[model samples]
Target: MTLMLCSVAAAASAHAGELPRLRTEDGRHALLVDGKPYLMLGAQVHNSSNYPSVLPQVWPVMQALSANTIEIPVAWEQFEPTEGRFDYSWVDTLLAQARKNDMRVVLLWFGSWKNGDSTYTPEWVKSDTKRFPRLQKRDGRPTTTLSPLGEATLAADRKAFVALMRHLREVDREHTVIMVQVENEIGSHGVARDYSPAAERLFAQQVPEDIRRASGKQSGTWAEVFGKEADQAFAAWTYARFVQEVAVAGKAEKNLPLYTNAAVFDATGTAMAAQVASGGPNWNVLPIWKTAAPALDLIGPDLYLPLEKTYLGLLDRYARPDNALFVPETSNAIWAVRFFWAALGRGAIGWAPFGMDATSYSNYPLGARKLDPATIEAFAAPYRLFRPIARDWAAIASKHPTWGTAKNSAGEDSTSMGSWKISVTYGRNNFDIPWPGMEPPPWAKEPVGGGVVAQLGPNEFLVAGQYSRFQFMPVDPAVNGQIMSAEEGTFIDGRWQASRRWNGDQISYGFNFNEQPALLRVKLSTY
Candidate 1:
């Protein structure tokens, strides 16, 4: 612990005036904290579970889960209950609790929108429908979503967000709060888009030049330019512009990385887009949001998709050089751990499961409820392993190419990274003294193995995985590859403490890892 503290101190000392910022290198992105790249092992609380009394439940569970950051809501209703007055007791309390627990925070601002509903808005704003109107449907029915076209609505949200940022700057100069989520799953719901007069007027005009440039269209009305998808595109433009204004205001107060999360379009596409939140950064509308909201740092998707390919595809879509991949909210299911490796392989800065406290919501998904003991154990595995090598992992992730694979029924999988073709097999003891057979453990029958391989050099690799074995072969036929050294170790106090030199039978077949995550440094040579 003392050495860890010294390492942290050294990092802070190295960069005297640099504020917390995001850096991109070698086509990958990382969040630099206190002059060192940090990976966020995060868990979020329920929407209504961030008050002082409820927070006690939050810390214990997060600590048990080994989360380094807590994502919780700071609602507009709670922050400013009345019109012109603000209360920051909630924010102060959260900072104090996070400091005590040695955790960082990604404060989710539930201002104008939370899950496509304005239920978290202040009472004053909600009551004045004329001044701050709700989004009107095509048939003259008003939805619960706030109209992004309203000047009063945007102004009020911008004011409140700026106030919160100003307060954070005054009280949190050390940056206990690392990032701020501008809103929660923001978009229009229950309708494709607003049918109000203002929205209709904007839709009727020539598609804004910037939006046209972003979406690769030119000089046409929404209907003419986008055809059937124009409604959702128009809505995305207005909503992103509104959020962008709020973001610009808050950044003016204190510049910190700000992002928004999308309620991704499911497989049903048209129906889902019509009924669910279709605007804000959904894959199809991502270009519109990016062009309209220049103030936003990144846009990430909430992982609610049921299929693995769909989930992985979304990771590929958003994991672009221009944007950083962050799963700010996800399920707590045991199988979800594989996506953590997937995200890391794509150079994501963070991964977090939503609703992690000792509380439950009626309408929530099964894996998104309060944590049970088993769930905590499931989450703790990856977090405990990553927390130690967080700095190293972030540094390596930005500049090096990496690959990850989930176990197959055959208990083996292979992928290419750099000049090596890496083969991974899942099983138990590899040593002949313990078990002389090639057969795997009973658990190997299940999808219980997965790992990430990062190429540190042409023949040198950093391998971390659970319940798996690794064997690397050179891609160049003329060169024969053989492992020169394989040292299994733990990163303690910023130094690798080798536990056992893996040789003899261990290296004869392959390097084996148990259920616990094992970090190894392997060097290869050509003959």
Candidate 2:
């Protein structure tokens, strides 16, 4: 069996008129760039690194990480500091530099809200509080977040977003900007919904017909329709409608697969709406967002949760048939890198870690404290290994059944492929059985191990991973299984070149993959 590579170079040379789009089939999705499947091995720079001056500190990290795409923010304040008088200088600079480095861009529009705050709005808008109203708390005191109920705010944000898209159309004809994030971590913080007089009037009004139908409530006020989740549900609808208008207008200018990022909260449904980013597209409210914002291609989660259960659970929640999984922001910490496999197994179109730049700032508890070599390598290793066959993997994942896992606190995980049970053990050495009095391995205590396996055929598999050991066993108790052949190879320019074959000592024990990048094509047979 052979795996065909989708060459990035070939994709770049496609017809310039072709725009990037998301294609979904059989509950799987692919980000098609230049009319072909594209895998975004992406890095998101620091929030303030969008200007021309700070870009000098960004490129080196992209090169080091081997990232093909950069998710950088284009602040509303900076993009249109003077409102109607727009400036596209920084965008032009970014596009020119990105092309020079052969990188695609995922522009984050930090408009109406960012992390549920209005800090990114222009001075003109911020100074005029009456025109762009802020969300009011229960005490009737205005909060920092912009009110989703404000028509003026939505109109202004939609205008700015449209202008940015129009500018992109004029400049990026080659489709260098693969996608645009409508806003960043949108929602309210202190309260579930705005308590202003205008918001109160609307809250008492009957829920819109579309929302009523989506929620299976024929007709009633927001409070009556949603019951306990009334406030959050209302808030979600308000934000979704606001963003939908902006996305619709922007798409009209140049449709390039628009999406928004959510500040993920409790996945277990224990956290109250008021405790999390209430109005955002959190997992619980995805249905509301989907029904309200049909124009948005997808809503991705900004994963800060590092636990195996939570991280993997969130992936399952977001990777649905109606919504394509695209992790726009995740922790850049060493332990978090393994979830890259989890995302891939879920058929995620793209995954990016937050705060990936040479800038001296770091979002500590959320990511690595510093950009150390170890931290950098943790993320770089997977990208380096998959860079050559990214397109191939994307295509295969979109079509085939795949499974991936990371070393959990228990240090192991397993899944089934066809008739075989594939078990992966982390921190294992070449030896399957420990000698007398053998101590545990050093990596056993370390937080680094995971891998992904894809079924190429009924009895053939493609596997790549690090710091783990893979063993396959027959599911049927009566049958025995053995590896027919295992080839160690790497894909180059869409072709697999075998460097060697594994047998005897190598096949004596299950495949032991260490820190070094290893790709294996193993054919199995039942005896």
Candidate 3:
């Protein structure tokens, strides 16, 4: 039983609040602390939840990200393998260490969902099929599911969770665990929806109007919920109900935030349609889940898509005022730099690139393939000062997505990472500020500061690295601050180039530049 104090002196000194809340400011949503928007720049460690021994090594990575909170899972099998046997040493240790690091956390309940399977069921429940129901495949063979209707299984899960929640109230009533994910990537596989006897009976009955009405959905039977495929949405609705029950039990004791993560396939009506109609958190069924799981506060998407534009676009679609923008997981790549910058600039609550382990070999998802040396360098730039960099950047990203967003030209006419499918765009000269640098891994360039850095106003910004200077030029008098002179350049793709240089170092005083990253010290005054 240790304390987890998650705040930096610069940010924490002014705020006095027990817990954090999400808020909207200047047209962006940010996590509010002490009634002010707080940014969360974080990363998801690789298998950090299952292995405590890896913590020492894994924690370093989390520290590097400057993460305000960690998303860790407590599996049912690991905690209570045998019927009533419950062990919390791993979690306790994690909590204690989190306190040591002054970090906050969001716990994922690995009860019935972890990648859409009951793989973490305790041995008692795993072995005893009589008490726990299983999902059925199209052919009627049992699919993976702990009977949504199983009295014993649900009772066991509820009790274990309630106990866990009660203990949290006793030990962490201070709100160390700000939020809890009801389950991880909850959705059925190899099966559209549960077709078990109990599940089947529930589906056959009349539609739960509370659900239909909540959705304002054109309703009839499961068949009419959509058209011909309403049954799938119906089945997903039923499973949601199951998860909602477990969530209700845990949230009853402590009123901390609660949410669920959806393993996104695509945004086109078709992709999400399958998950929804087949018993997933499709947008349509959102109204359904809202009704069923009133206790759950948010629903998020875990993205690993190669399509950068589309992937981020999906995040934008789901990121609503009622639903905060939280990217639970993503692949670690160079573009992540831009994405992270954009997400923060847009007011994202959290952003994590998966595989936060020490394994240098790299184990990102399939969609995250094709990392050239340049991309590697781009990603490396932050790792040199992970925690400091992430924290500093995350503060702005989480609080002001619009703030972190800046449009600068590439330094060279053309620059491409060796194997990357993408390119860095810049103006002309390959200067550090305006130009996207040649791939320099975070591990390569030693960082001197504690947190990450980014530009804010014209010439104003906070730095996490030491003794580094960047170059830039004035474009729109509105954003470009006062410069010594003009430096003509154009960005090809993602790289930049400086063709001509004008003498402005004489007048580059702190006039026009207010909070810009590149124009630090040099003022960008309004002409």
Maximum-lDDT candidate? 2
Report the C-alpha lDDT of model 3 over 1-527, residue by residue, as the tens digit.
00111334334546654555555555555555443444445556554345678777667666555466677778888888777778878778878887787777777788866777788878778777766767776567886676456777777888888877877887874456766777777776655676666666777676787877886766576765656556556766766777788888877877566788777766665445554325666555677777777677777777776665556566776676667777777776644554554455345677667665554445645423443444434444444333333333344544322323222222111111121111122321223334455663242232111112234443433322211223333444354333443333322221223455435452232112111122121223434
Candidate 2 local lDDT, 166-190, one digit each (tens): 9999989988999999989888886
TM-score per prediction, in order, is 0.93, 0.96, 0.72
Candidate 1 regions exceeding 4 Å error are 1-9, 265-271, 360-370, 407-412, 426-442, 445-448, 477-479
Q: 186, model 2: CA deviation in Å?
A: 0.4
Candidate 3's error at 394, in angstroms? 7.7
The count of residue-pair clashes in candidate 3 stands at 81
Query: What lDDT does model 2 reach?
Result: 0.87
- Candidate 2: clashing pairs of residues: none
User: Which residue segments of model 3 deviate by more than 4 Å?
Assistant: 1-17, 23-28, 32-36, 271-278, 359-364, 367-527
Local distance difference test values of all predictions, in order? 0.82, 0.87, 0.56
TM-score of 2: 0.96
Worst-scoring 10-residue span by lDDT in model 1: 361-370
Question: Which residue ranges in model 2 land beyond 4 Å of their true spot?
Answer: 1-16
